[model samples]
Target: MKPKQTLSWKPFVLSAAVLLILFPFVYLVLLSLASEWRFPDLLPSYFGLRNWATILGSEAGLLESFVSSLLISLSVAMVSTTSGFLISRAVFYHPKKNTLTLLAYFPYILAPVVFAACLSFFFLKMGLFGNITGVIVAQFIIAFPYALLFFSSFWNKKVKSYEDLVATLGGNRWQTYIKVLFPLAKGLLLICFFQTFLISWFEYGLTSIIGIGKVQTLTIKVFLFIKEANYYYGALSCCLLIFPPIVLLYFNKRYVFKKLV
Candidate 1:
């Protein structure tokens, strides 16, 4: 007879964790639509669409800030993902994989504030201060590690066999990568793109310090509003800021779960 599987606590544990994670998101949605939110109420006194309308209809450059964030984030995602893929590919195929992997992971291990401070000096000396290009460069640096780490792991495991098989079939390295390796890595690449996008989108300190006041992102806008006690509007801004990542994840839900599992 086949052995019976034991009933495990894993399902209960996972269900609890899922609910814990989702509780905040459910609360945020509630708060965003709340018309009369107050502390000690345990919930909003009233609920309406006014908060969403006020933000979506406002001329406070709210839309521009959204557009700016999208543009910067997409730019950072594309550049970092592409650059990281190339760098990780080089490192993976190098004779000294451990050494190169260490180099790739170093940036990610550093403190963000410390890294931003170091980058600030470089931007100042290079006359790149207070510019979008400077901000993009900084975001790229910060996002590269995430892309590299994800792609590197996927490339090593999923594409290694195909890579060697292609080599044995007389295909050159470049052709093999384009036709074989890249296709297998596409899902992970998409995941990295979304990850890098979120990193750039929510990043505040580096963008603020590096871009000064000339460049404004959604995170910076939210921070400013909060400082000025614009609670309702700030909540709206925070809701808008979270939409992109939510959308990205929604579309990539299958791939995300596959990777996680």
Candidate 2:
């Protein structure tokens, strides 16, 4: 007869950690599907798609908010990433590169609320207040600098050598970027876009202050739901919130990270 096999604790530990991480998401989904899930209940009194069905009508407005947030975040990410990549190259070759790089951190020097307060006057003067455009521009201000700093590290001595070699091979400045630089920095660019997208997606203080409560991104909607003590709607909104990031993560891991590896 064989001796009894010992049970390994590693699997149990990993399973516990994974459950801890996933519990909030699972609870959110369940809560979104539930009604009358009051205190002291091991399970919800009712759990179905009733709460989710609200998104199909004007009652919830979550669908609109989700679409608005997606558009704003995608715009901010694309603009910030492209501009940051192009401008950082110029900064890399500037006489006062360090000074300009230091200036890139200016937006981060203040809390988002204070930063938004300081910019409110200009936004109002430019007729950007209480609108989607204003929210995009405001988020850009915060995300752009972050993208700038992120891509700044991509321009270094090795990149310079590649640029020189490209020039030697009869490549123009544009050709060097299109052929060599862009391809080499493909992974970094995708990562930066993802980061900037998340930054804009979750931005609240600046969005609220700059938008003057008119622009309702998902983040703002989430807070509104919580403030009203509507847990069902809040959980539903949160489910919508994490959906985009998870998709991005899946694509990044499958395409960008695979190529990177």
Candidate with the greatest TM-score versus the true structure: 2
| Candidate 1 per-residue lDDT over residues 155-203, each given as its tens digit | 5654777878888999998899789867877887888788888899989
Look at candidate 2 and tell me the lDDT of residue 246.
88
Strongest candidate by lDDT: 2
lDDT of 1: 0.81
Residue 211 lDDT, candidate 2, scale 0-100: 81
Question: Which lDDT tens digits does candidate 2 get at residues 187-242?
Answer: 88998899889999988899999987689888889899999999999999999999
Question: Looking at model 1, which ten-residue stretch has the lowest summed lDDT?
Answer: 150-159
Per-residue lDDT of 259 in model 2: 29
TM-score of 2: 0.90
Per-candidate TM vs. native? 0.79, 0.90
Query: Cα lDDT of all candidates, in order?
Result: 0.81, 0.89
